[model samples]
Target: MSKKDKNSSNSRRDFMKTSATALAGFYIVPRHVLGGPGFIAPSDKLRVASVGVGGMGGGDVRGIYGTGKVDMIALCDVDDSRAKQSVEAHPKAKYYKDFRVMLENEENNIDAVSVSTPDHMHAVIAMMAMKMGKHVYVQKPMAHDIYEARMLTEAASKYKVVTQMGNQGSSGDGVRKMVEWYDAGLIGEATKVYSWTNRPVWPQGIPWPEKGQTPPKDLDWDLWLGTAPYKDYVENLVPFNWRGWWDYGTGALGDMACHIMEPPFRVLGLGYPKSAECSVGSVYVGEFQQGYFPESCPPSSHITLRFDRPGKEDLEFHWMDGGIQPTRPEELEANEQMGDGGNGVIIEGTKGKMMCSTYGINPQLLPTSKTKDINVPETLYRVPKGDQGHYANWVEACIGGYGSKEFDLLSSPFSVAGPLTESVLMGNLAIRSYDYRAPRKENQNQFDYPGRGIKLLWDGENMKITNFEPANQFVKRQYQGDYSL
Candidate 1:
């Protein structure tokens, strides 16, 4: 797909007219420029750059490079050694220790950039790319905080740049089919959703390790810290464990919720919850605590969120973590195993139920009886055959054409906003209130916002918390000195 093919005739005409008006001397042509017989190729092959070259970033680089249609022109990472694979993968590409410098030096060479950086840096970097007229694909949770998410969304619309959030599950055919199933009343008006994860394999909550150990020779600690407030470079926080800390990441919810909670949030049109609060087990409060947080950042945790349905009265949704599955339905045989690990979502309706894993790609109906029966309603949309590769979907969108209404960020506000905010931030809230005493062993199942924590009325359109001033302030963080929001 190329820009010529991506925009329809009307869109191309509008773009050309806009471009011509913006640049007085440039002549705009609506005709597709040809590079081969009967072929109008991309204006030029997309020259791509990647930031944050370790872990998820490394995987993203591989995916984009595999397409063979893009030129992996630049790779950037604070840790030189961690960027080795990317450097090897695209031997001809330039390497940079800072993304800001890379953008400054190669502003005109790149067509798009993939941001696999931590949650905090997502908005800043993506905004820079969009301002430069380059398309952007950033990893999930979209932004570090609610304010940044709103800013990124607005910027994308303002610049009219092709944008994709790295909730790759959004591209799955199974997700779309599931939405169709809900629309056709298979699950019968999905009033409640439960999604959970078991993550943070890295050490967290444990006392910070001694700081005397030397930093890796290839690591630039200062650049890696970027806009985050200064703190000693502890060995425990680096390489991968930052997800558990509030200063750097949003814990397990931020790490996995975007993918797992996507299906229900989208299909059910679950807008913002009226109020959300967190409850946890065995964590103690501390003197330095500024908000509700888990006492010790436990390896395993659980959180539940409640919402008032638009016209449906009170509707509740619960999330459990630490490999804890919800009470198995009694209809199943006593010996049946509960859902576990990676991630899963359970939607319980007034009638029967439907459950699936993160991508919903290979979902299974409840009760083994349903699986064996041939009378199940035919799935509304046929699940697209074969792997509809995540990166391919984004790249295709970037090049123009082959778009999906169901998966587009703009098209699925409920899918993107509800889960993105609740999953990640709810964990943060739980961690903040970690010291709060739980009244029972199953606090997550019975946690109440109005009874204990500050109750907030969310105004999604204005991105404001209407009820509590303190809670509104909490939505946006104070930038470190010399760093701007």
Candidate 2:
């Protein structure tokens, strides 16, 4: 190895050794003792811990274990009931409800962490883990806001940690195929993209519950509200309904766009949107009146974002949710499924168009026959097991340690997921702005949505809305109490 390479390697080893000694009080197991007949050394096995092991979090923990190359060292979650399965499954693993406690105590033993919490807590949990020299695999949207995403993306490089976002489609072959096809000129110069989802399947567009139900006996309501402003426990907000609330969720666009729109984002080499505009659905309070719920996301929204491509022509991207869909392209066959029935994306260009369902699965060209006719070379490499390999890929990357080829090969590393998330949240900014209201001075009972009517201009670098001041508020949010980025 070159002298520089040797010095870097020694530096990393020295840091790990120094950190291990500093925390020996909490981590007493010897590396060699963890090795024995028919077993790899525990030091060699990537030691992984997880936060929020329920629902998708539960699935993430299992996926990482399924790789068989990692040691499950610890698990954390605010709700005891939700963490039951993971705790029962890993009998030897340490358990805790507070992530900060787990991290402080287990820092010497863990090589990486899986953050599968709600949207608002993602950045804080993952950022703290990354800062402590642990590789991180964080679930989608990356963060609750654009500014947080940008910060985590920059943090990934600064910390020199291996990182991956839980946008599994990023590891799928379909997206790679789309990228290669675009590079091959199969679709000419792309100019537009549309993505839609049938989501917010939970309650939205309603007022926050005025009264509190008794909090679940096994759940810590305040801890679950991490990073978001505190609120009295409401019925059905735990488990999954939180997606409808602005404080805890990023709405339907944040929940599904990462999976459905990733292929288009990857293929186009897109960046921040130059401007955004949106129209939202309204709930009826009476035959002639409409209800407004500022704390809840709209039931439906159609957002358009324009991008200034560096060398190519400007592009327009449309995002729809709450079962809204774009008009069918004339080139598609009448019988073909429109993006797996409930979720899908379509990219249009001068010569042709391409479409795919969530996770970038089932990709096909317009006319359907084009998929069979096209012979574009496979220039981009595919993950070993397509989307299923995403977990193992991150595990292996962590085992490869940081700065190795394996680390750099992660498909959805923060370097990429960060910007993708920021782009997706731009739509939410428009959706929220569509509902922004100030008291109408002439009428005390009514309000005017000053945030509407104009295209909200954006300055990506500065992370602000150049045209509308109120819309910029969604760019970054205030963290409550001890939680922060």
Query: What are the candidates' C-alpha RMSDs?
Result: 8.9, 8.0
Clashes of each: 13, 0
Best by TM-score: 2
lDDT of 2 by residue, 244-333 (tens): 999999899999999988888877766677888888887976542356577889899888989876556789999999999999989887
Instruction: Return model 2's CA RMSD, one decimal.
Output: 8.0
The lDDT leader among the candidates is 2
Instruction: List lDDT for all candidates, in order.
Output: 0.61, 0.82
Which residue ranges in model 2 land beyond 4 Å of their true spot? 1-43, 286-289, 434-447
**Tens-digit lDDT string for candidate 1 (1-485):** 12222232123212111221232353323326422211113444567899987788999898877776788889999888888888887899999998889998988788788999877777788888878877787887777777777677667667666676777666666566566556556657666777776665665554444364567889888777776777667765677787766667766767777877776765665544555555544333354332233312555566656654545655566766556567666655787543444568878777667777776656655774674442444443221232346676556546542122212322222224433554356445434532234554454322223322554455555656566544554467776655553
